[model samples]
Target: MPSRFTDEREITGVADLTPVQRDQLRAAGKLYDGEDLDAAARLVDDPDDERSFLGFCNLWRVVDGSEDRYDAWLYQVDSGTIFRAGTTDVAAEIIQFGLETRDPAVRAELGPALVEAGLLPKSDVSYPEFAGLLRTQQGA
Candidate 1:
């Protein structure tokens, strides 16, 4: 199965967009917002490249599209927590640790998962909790 992170994505920035390109992006963004990755890919120039594709995925997460889990991942990445929960079973334990131990490290590790899962708030969660959660989950 294709993981959320595609290997060939790129990022040329917004200035690189054209009117038609903008339209395609808008369409793709909308499709992504609607939880339709296939449809979004159709609006993009290269589905295999990282730029437009990563942008689409980022947009999807920003809009809290498709699954909340993806949003959680984005949020955590934005906050400098590079870790991802791997899969649902892995993610569940991470989240539970955050609820149980209030460990910042664990939370830091799991923060991305929360962002992907769309569970985090606008305010950045504490780093200690994230770290602890991550450690706990890792130990498990």
Candidate 2:
């Protein structure tokens, strides 16, 4: 069975967005308001709202042509704990980004999954270093 994250329809750009989806993306952007991921997550009052928020965050690159901003959004989502409850595609994307950016937080959150996915080896030394950083942050 296809996962909920698996959208068969391809949305190429802003022009391809539906009116409601566009509105949701705009609302989500407002909630994001200058790099605040917690604020965006707070706007999600329910599952439907969460889905809309994540969808916008995930596809913002297509609309704005900003991969770095999208990576920031993914990092924020993971930091906000939304990524823990996100779909497979969300996890996979974040893991991929983590590997690319060497983001300790993302590595800490998805280390095991990364190994399982073969993106990182089980013996990866960086996992311990990143996990230690995560522990320090949690303890702080």
What are the models' TM-scores? 0.25, 0.25
The runs of at least 3 residues in candidate 2 whose Cα sits more than 4 Å from the true structure, single-residue gaps closed, are 1-3, 8-12, 34-140
**Full-model lDDT for every candidate:** 0.34, 0.35
Q: Please estimate how well model 2 matches the true structure, expressed as its whole-model Cα lDDT.
A: 0.35
lDDT of 2 by residue, 1-140 (tens): 10111122323245555554444444444433433333334335465553334333343221112212121233233321112221211222333234433455444444433333333443555566544544554463
lDDT of 1 by residue, 10-124 (tens): 3334454444434434443333344333323434566574423444323222111233232122211232112222221212122312322245544343454344344444354
Q: What lDDT score is found at residue 1 in candidate 2?
A: 11
- Model 2: lowest-lDDT 10 consecutive positions: 62-71
